[model samples]
Target: MLEIKNKLYNSKERKMQKLFNKYMGIKKFFRLKSEKIFPLNENEKILYTDKYDYKEKNEKNKSDKYLSFNKRIHILSVIPKNKIENFYYSFCNFVKKNPSKNEFSKIILDERLKKSILNYSNSLNLGGWSNLGYTTPKSKELENIVDYFHLFIFNLSEDYIGLDFTAILNKDFNHKLNEFMISEIKNEPNYCKYYVGNKRFISKTGLNKDIIRREKLDDILLEIKMRCYDFLNLYFDLFPLNNKAPITFDEYITNYEFNSKNDYLLRCYDFYIFEDKQISRDMDIIINHNDKEFSQTFLDLYLC
Candidate 1:
């Protein structure tokens, strides 16, 4: 049954749904197949690489801000080889259940939503008041209130495979409307290049700051900004203000290659590190962008 809001958003909702459904359906089918092909006796393990860094501004910098050394601990989750099928379906369901484009766009930019998601992710060192355009010393209650809402698009990975942006896809998928939409994600002018990693279903649970330390969660915070950049990239692909030819994702990437400090840059994990034993409960570390030595050190302890 269509609700009143559904009626209002029907055109866009249907359009987005149609384009994405095929991708979702196909992905769902394969994920289910992966079950028998790759059996699993337990919940999956997720591996991811994300860095977080911040600067304490001094002299010679143009803007008044600096990147923090606090890292994001870029986490990826998997449910188990046996659960891939179920995980993908859950992810697709979330996409279909996603709020209308208008709703998502508006909520994402809202300061209230920002505080809710950020604080829920972690409370320490959220920077000064007004840093996120809100009054300082926000109450946890205010943050939890929006827990009932969806603040962004998420993909829940199942099993041991680390499904991430690095997954393989076409050289460029602008031809596919869903890919086109994804291409619109805003990215910094100089963030690292992203190639098609793989096709996988994904979803998100709210961030658990307790599980991830403030020093590490900071990197996760930055990854959130990178995703915001991803959205802009797709949006620009669909709508361009320039009279001349609109740029491609590659072009946008090229433009920002060296100018990430500008607002146009996508924020990402750049600083901080954490030992694996501190966080892993049966969780294992697989891929990490941090130095191999550091990763190995963590891995060694995790094994011990």
Candidate 2:
């Protein structure tokens, strides 16, 4: 009888010990990755690189005018892997079918450049705040209140792959439009036909700092990803722009790319491809006067 009683008590003690250890494990995890609340600053702050660094920043935020969120939230907008792959495959097929007209397609067809494009698409970083502008939660009602609302701004031209003036379609089309528009307008040299990357997207989210410090921050980031994804989808579907009649290729390209900071040089092929188009056919024709090698290379690529 005594042996049976002893066994019962021993089992109960072991179970209690396991429960205590579980609780302590979670407590320690929170202590390791806690966040701080701080005021906004104009200067840049280094982003968190590791678990230890995040914990250290939490302590630093305890000082005046400095508060840190449990973790930074950044989500890439949905450009699905399958879709990107399909785009590449379709592009390759198009190049094979339309080889003559698409002399510039070789840039995208290069195996090394294509690999780089795939890798960049897989790890694209699309959305996040430069620095958060935080305000105290409006109400004392803890149920409704949050730590802060953060705003993220994105510039399409510099942040994406296969955009800007890199694509042959954009380069050729923009050049043709800019030339015609410039001749018609007086003192307007900066106008262009179409912009390669002049779009921006801004997003916002509210987070519960208390839950984040006591728990894992990955949950908050997951929620942020969903919200950001919706915003991006809507923005892409209904891009807001003022509708206007078409202008010459030079004027069109000039309007968007003049100060866009994209690196591209005007080539003879780019000029020749759009020369026969009706909108730009009236513009004074200019041949590539310099770089005989480049001109010859362009001719060879198109077999012109």
Candidate 3:
């Protein structure tokens, strides 16, 4: 009887271990699939380094390998003027506490805060959104808070593209916020006007909102043009314009423009070098970006 009981216990432990391993295997499969779908930009690749277990690897090599996971921390929310203070303090306190061990028990002190914070461990790997209220297996202390803060912000705002928190996390909060606000003015002029009109909120944040709005729009515009030029340089290098003379970024942008959806499709195919097999495999990415309805549906899967 004793021998039989020991065998049963051992068998059950083995089964549990097998299940855990299987779960991890499935998770890894989907993660790889997602990466293949949405390739990370160069700047983003630098900040995305949490996928691997550094403990098993050499200590010296850990930092190098640990630097490659999420590109930007994005938040897409319209945080109300009344709740800004409460949200900011709650977030600051949460960060200060660094409660990775206790999980969601102390995530938000205010039960009145209705938005459920979501965690996207990998920005590109949009398999599913995990609730911040639960502890993720093997997640590092405070890693989720810093890396996945964007999802929380997404729940807050209804208008405009999400805010990029990458600059803020990298200790360039003020500069990034100014640039973002400036960008917002260009992208949604009316929205920016309304947001900055709130004098009380502007005072509370100590943002250089007035200076940028009044004096720096042209500077921001020039900076944006430079960024686009640089981005095109990278883009052209990755997806060369076949049969066309290698042109300067300025020349290319000035002379060549996508006149229609078909023109864009042709350019996309050129990027893949017109390899039938490769194009067929990666066509979904091209379609998702170019096709407005499908793009919305695809985004809704993750953001909605």
Number of the top-ranking candidate, with lDDT as the measure: 3
lDDT (CA) per prediction: 0.28, 0.29, 0.29
Per-structure clash totals for the candidates: 57, 29, 12
Our model 3 lands, by Cα RMSD against the true structure, at: 27.9
| Model 1 residue 129 lDDT score | 22
Q: Model 3, poorest ten-residue lDDT window?
A: 245-254
lDDT, model 3: 0.29
- Model 1, 1-304: lDDT tens digits are 0012222223575567545545644654565567677753332211111112222232232344332221111222222334434434443343344332344322224456344433322223333122111111122321211112121212233213222211111122212312222222321111111245674444212222222232233232233323322332332222222322111111011112222233322212121234333444322222233465643222211111
Write model 2 residue lDDT over 93-161, tens digit each, in one string.
Answer: 533432333232223357774664455444545542222122222222211212332322223333343
Poorly placed runs, candidate 2 (over 4 Å): 1-78, 100-110, 126-304
lDDT tens digits, residue span 160-274, model 3? 1121222112224323533443243221111011154555211011123333332243233223223322322331221132322221111000122224454432232232222
Ranked by TM-score, the better of candidates 2 and 3 is 2
Better of 1 and 2 by lDDT: 2
Q: Candidate 2: minimum summed lDDT over ten consecutive residues — where?
A: 295-304
Tell me the spans in candidate 3 whose CA falls farther than 4 Å from its real position: 1-70, 98-259, 263-304
Please list the residue runs of candidate 1 whose C-alpha ends up more than 4 Å from where it truly belongs after superposition: 1-75, 99-159, 165-304
TM-score, candidate number 1: 0.20
